[model samples]
Target: MASFFAALMNSLDIALLLFIIAIGLNIVFGVLHVINFAHGAIYMLGAYAGYSCMAMLGLPFWLALIVAPVPVVLLAIVIERLVLSRIYDRDVADSLLLTFALMLILNESIRMVWGTGIYVIDPPAMLQGTVTLFGNVTYPKYSMFVIVMGMLVLAGLWWMFNRTRVGHIIRAAAIDREMSQLVCINTRFVITAVFAFGAWLAAVGGVVAAPMRAIDPGMGDKIIIESFIIVVIGGLGNFTGTLLGAIILGLIHGFGSRYFPEVNLLLPFIGMALVLLFKPYGLMGSGGR
Candidate 1:
């Protein structure tokens, strides 16, 4: 019983992390209609940047968490303006190819800068210990911090999408790009900003994940596959769907690995296949506009 509760808590943490990454993907797709292959690289950069700030510059973990993702966000903006903008009206296949090339370039660049090695960050002293739950199960305090941060991000994103003027602009663009432009919304600017925001979210996920997992050049590869699965299952370009998808995948991974170890690796893809078959647009996805 205790073990089950511990696993459940851990699963929730993993799910939250997935949510962070997948939500960004959903937003970019939702607004710009571009599937950013470089998102995973942005995530990797976030982890390395946080690692450098903490290890090389001697910054506090909390401070690194705050500052590490800024440069990536800036880079994302630059890329959107200089490169992604050119492909906006191109075929989806063209955008995918271009972005995949960018992904390779970014991954190689990270290897050159950070070296091809695995790195890990230690949790801050305050979050270093564990708390006992349900009599005997112990859970990491850092995991709890991650879960809290994830919830805060979800709340913040929801407010941004539903309450703010910028949110309204983004929503407008997502609903109908040409219509938004006709109404005098600078959709070009909105697209760039939305892509940058997505990169920012991915970077934050990387920073948060750095302490929880091994960080290497290839770490992004693993998460990107999972992230794609989340977005696809949740519904492309649907924020609420991304959240639901992430939680479902998280729970699947959590219990599947524990209870059905032999087939754990195949379960997510199987579930995705099923979702695609039954509800081609995704469980929560409305028909594409």
Candidate 2:
């Protein structure tokens, strides 16, 4: 029973980490209608940046976590203004191609800078210990920290989307860009802001994940596939759906690996296929723009 509880805690950790990455993908798709193929690269950049700050500069983990994502967020703003802005209304294929190209460029650039080696960041000293749960079972404090951070992020996102004026404006733009423009909403600015915000979120996820996962050039590629799956399964353009999808996928990854190892790798895709077959628009997706 204790072992089962430990597994459940681990599953929650995975789900929360996924939510951090997948929510950003959902928001970008929800508002900008672009697939953001470079998102995973941005995530990788965040991880590397955090790694450098902590390992080389001798900064504390907390400081690295706070400072590492800023540059990536700025890069996103620049990319939005310079590249993505040009493809806003073009065919989806065009945006996909452009972002795919951007992804390749970013991936190569990361290799150039980071030397294509696998790196690992140690969890903060405060999070290094294990907590005794029931009798003999133990759980890492770092996992608990991750779960807490994920919940905080979830709440923060909820407040940003539902309570703030900017959130309302963003939702309006997502719902009807033309109508928003007619009402004097500068949707161009909103789109750029949304893109940057999404990128920032992805970067934060990367930083959070770095201590837990091996960092390498290939990390971005792996995450992009899973991130894309999460966004699609949750319903494109649906933030709430992204959360649900991330949790479900996280659980599948965690429990499936333990209980159904033979087919674990294929389970998420199977679930995606099933969801698409029945809902077509995704669990929370709406028809049309």
Q: Which candidate is the best by lDDT?
A: 1
Local lDDT at 240 for model 2: 82
Candidate 1 ranges with C-alpha deviation above 4 Å: none
Model 1's lDDT to the true fold? 0.91
Tens digit of lDDT per residue, candidate 2, span 39-58? 99999999999998998999
Please give the lDDT score at residue 199 for candidate 2. 84
Give the range of the ten consecutive residues with the poorest summed lDDT in model 2. Answer: 280-289
- Clashes within 3 Å, all models in order: 0, 1
Candidate 1 lDDT at 15 equals 92
Q: Alpha-carbon error at 201 in model 2, in Å? A: 0.7
